[model samples]
Target: MAGVRKRYGGKRALDGFDLTVERGTVHGVLGPNGAGKTTAVRVMTTLLRHDEGLVRVAGHDVRDRGREVRRRIGLLGQHAALDEDLGGRQNLEMFGRLHHLGARRAGVRADELLERFGLMDTGRKAVKLYSGGMRRRLDLAASLITEPEVLFLDEPTTGLDPRGRAEVWGAVRSLVGGGTTVLLTTQYLEEADQLADRISVVDSGRGVAEGTPDELKARIGGDRIDVVLHDADRLADGAHALAHAAGTHAVSTDVDRRLLSAPVADRMTALTETVRALHARGIEARDIALRRPTLDEVFLQLTAARGAGRPGATERQEMPA
Candidate 1:
């Protein structure tokens, strides 16, 4: 999408947004609530039209060739569209038939999908009886009944437990391995870091930042040194010592937890020097370690900065699920 703009009355859901995703990879779109992640996906999948800008999916323009775009894309939305009374295999077969695959072909396709998603053992079980992960996998399978070239997943693991999320992640990896191009929109930072080959962080209906997980993390700083002290009163001293030791005065401290954190140019050398500095100052630290910055920090810093700078902007609500 290039300079895509979608408006709803006085509100602009997508304001001059731009994104490019490579083929046969998982491209994650992440944002805080109402940042236009879902709106972007809807436009790309042909479910909603943009008032301006260019969008082409699977080599067909969404504006001029909606049918061609729809034919090449599959969408797994945030909600489940399955019939609770029907069995797993029955659900998939029904989807296949809806796509005009005949009885025999639908049955064969259903069985194939069931096996691929590791649902054959429980394919005959009613949908209501399946676990959250099982149900999501079934929903994912249903979307692929026609084997679309590009699949759009809008928070596919929302409200799922860790195990359930992991299950879906594995299934997604398998899909990408089989040459499927996936576009994922998720609020979970770790999900984006784990699953996305590259991520585009959107805010206020525009692309804020885009890169691999490591590249994004590097925006703020590099390795960090965390010093947890035994005494809360020494927090200030610890902070100063760490700033000097790390050769930077940009130290952050937590008084309640007696922790001091700062960015370091060199991991091992800075760690060694900081430890010596604390020892020389008779500061007893409970623990000290060097670690890379996390995606959580990156998300918080980037979104907070954007939110604070934008004026006359009320929080936008996402489209109804």
Candidate 2:
């Protein structure tokens, strides 16, 4: 996308947004609610036209070559679009036909998808009777009817239980295995961390950060060290000792919980040194652990920077779970 813009009166849905996804990789578009995520996908899939800038999908300009672009892409929106009155197999068959597959081929493809999605037994059951997970599986199967080279999944696992989310993740892995390029928009940070080859974090109406999960995480700092003391009264002492050992203002003490958390530039070596120092001071830790910062931490740091009255601030409010 180039200089893409969309407006609803005074509010801009997408403001000069741009994104580029490489082929045969899972590219995650992440953002909070009311960000341009949905709007960007809409423009890329030809569902909504951009007021400015060029949009392209699968090498076809979305505006001028919409039909060609549509033929190369399959889309699964945030909500499943299965017809409740139809059987799971029937829904896939109908989509196959819509993709221009003949009767015999469409039926065969539907059966194949049903088996692949582990819904062969329920293929004859009306989608209305299907559980949320099963319905989402069928919706995904329908989207794959044409076997398009590019797939657009917008929060495909939203509202799913853990098992359902796992099922979707499995399906995404399978798609990537088959060399299908996927453009996924999701609010789930873990989902993006687990599946995406590269991530582009969008907020408000523009891309805020883009990189691999590890690279993004590394931007915030390094490993974290947490120590729990036997007595709450020792928290302040532990904080001071740990902070002194770490050579940085890395300590945060929780008096009630008797916990001290400190950022260690090198946790493996620093943590052991801190533990030895505490022991020498006659302090005993009930528990201790070293951990890498998660994507959530990185996101917060980046968004917080933008929120601090920085130039080009566009981070939006967090998305609803």
Candidate 3:
């Protein structure tokens, strides 16, 4: 999308938004509430109209060729879109038929998808009888009935348990492995960390940052040097020592648990310096380690910048489950 703009009354949902996704990759889109993530996806998937700008999917313009765009893309929304009363195979076959496949072909495709998604054993069981993970898998299979080139997943694992989320995550990996380009919008940062080859951070209806997960994390800050003090009383002394070692006053200390954290550009050098400084100051450390910033941190930094700049910015709400 280029210069895409959509407004609800006076509020702008997308302001000069832009995103470029290469084929056969998992591209994750992330943002806090009301950041225009859902709007961008709706425009790209032809579910909503953009007031202005360019949107092309699978080489077709989304504006004039929405039907063609729909034909090439599959959307698995936040909730499972399945007939709970129908068996897994019946549900898939029904979807295939809706995609214009003949009855014989639909039955054959149902068997293939059932086997592919590991639902063959429960193919004849009603969807309501299936577990949460199984129902989601069936929903995914239904979306794939037409063999789409691009797939759109909007918070695909929102309410699932850990085991259920893992099942869906594994299925997503399998799709990308088989050369399907997936655009995922998720509230859970870890989901994006595990799935996305690249991520776009959106805020205030604009694309604020876009890069690989590691690249984005590097933008906010680098590896951190954390020292867990042996004594709670030494927290102040440890912070001062760490600040001296890190050459920055931006040291954070937790008094109750006695944890001191500081930003470090050079991991080994900082670690060595902090260790020596602690020894010289008669401070005992229970643990000292260097670790990278998490995706959650990146999300906060990006969205915080936007919210700070515009206090009353309109927020987005996901379509109710």
Candidate 4:
């Protein structure tokens, strides 16, 4: 949407927000609290209106043609919506009926979705008895009763444990594998790192950064060579060794963690050289690895960049409306 705008009394919730998601790809929207990720999703899904700019989804404008857009998009909110007293299949069938499918077709669609989500065995089981993962799967299945073209998932995996999160991630992968375009909003950085084909980092009602996970990670700096020293007191020496090996004075040390991090050009060569130099100098290291910057680091740096000089301001420089 161009020049999209939304406000809450005196505050701008979606101030000059802009985003473009391609078809058939899972686009991740990420930000910290009060970052306007939710507001942008609301405007895009037609749940809330934007005071300015244009939003086109599936070739239909969200403002003037909301019904057409709604028909093509399926939304799964943060929490699961399943009746505890009803069976899994019953809930799916009920959603199908609500989507205007006849009774016969609804039953067939429910069974199809149950099998697709690996819930066929528990189809007759009461939803309350289903595990956290099961409930999430059922919720996702309900959203697919009509097989919408674009899916909006607002934190589809929120409070689940590792297993439940994995199950939900698998379900999302399956949907994308079937050629569904998904716009996922979540606070989990790792989830975005794994599932998103591309990610948009939003802050203060605007997209501050956007790119593939790797691309975004690369922007923070370059490959990082990390060394964990066996001796806590050797932290300073380790940082010195890393700085020398990297041919630069840029090195960071976390004394509490006994780790030193530095940017490296030739990953393996720099790592090997550092190891050799440290060994020669008798500065023993517990472990060493050459790796890219983590998503957490990239996110921190990007968000910090947004506030580098300019504090949060009410007015944002305009783009083409």
The candidate scoring highest on lDDT is 1
Question: Can you write out model 3's per-residue Cα lDDT over 255-279, one digit (the tens) per residue?
Answer: 8778999999888999999999999
lDDT string, candidate 2, 1-321, tens digits? 878888655667777888889999999998766777887888898887778998888889998999999999999998888889999999998988887899999999999999988999999999999988898888988989999999999999999998898988998899899999999999899999999999998766778899999889878777888889997777777888888777678587887778888888876788778888798788889999898889888777766655543323222322212
Q: What does each candidate score in C-alpha RMSD?
A: 1.8, 3.4, 2.1, 4.1
- Per residue, candidate 4 scores C-alpha lDDT tens digits across 1-321 of 778888766677777888889899999999876677777777888988888889998899999999999999988988788898999999998999999999999999999999999999999999999999999999999999999999999888999898999999999999999999999999899999999999999877788999999999988888989899999988888788888898779898888889998998898889888988799779988889888888998888878766654324322221112
lDDT of 1 by residue, 221-279 (tens): 99999999999988888888999999999999888888899999989999999999999
| Cα-based TM-score, every candidate | 0.96, 0.92, 0.94, 0.94
C-alpha displacement of 127 in model 2, angstroms?
Answer: 1.8
lDDT of 2: 0.85
Order the candidate numbers by TM-score, best to worst. 1, 4, 3, 2
Off by over 4 Å in 3: 308-321
Clashes of each: 0, 0, 2, 0
lDDT ranking from best to worst?
1, 3, 4, 2
Off by over 4 Å in 4: 307-321
For model 4, which pairs clash? none
What are the lDDT figures for the candidates, one per model?
Answer: 0.91, 0.85, 0.90, 0.87
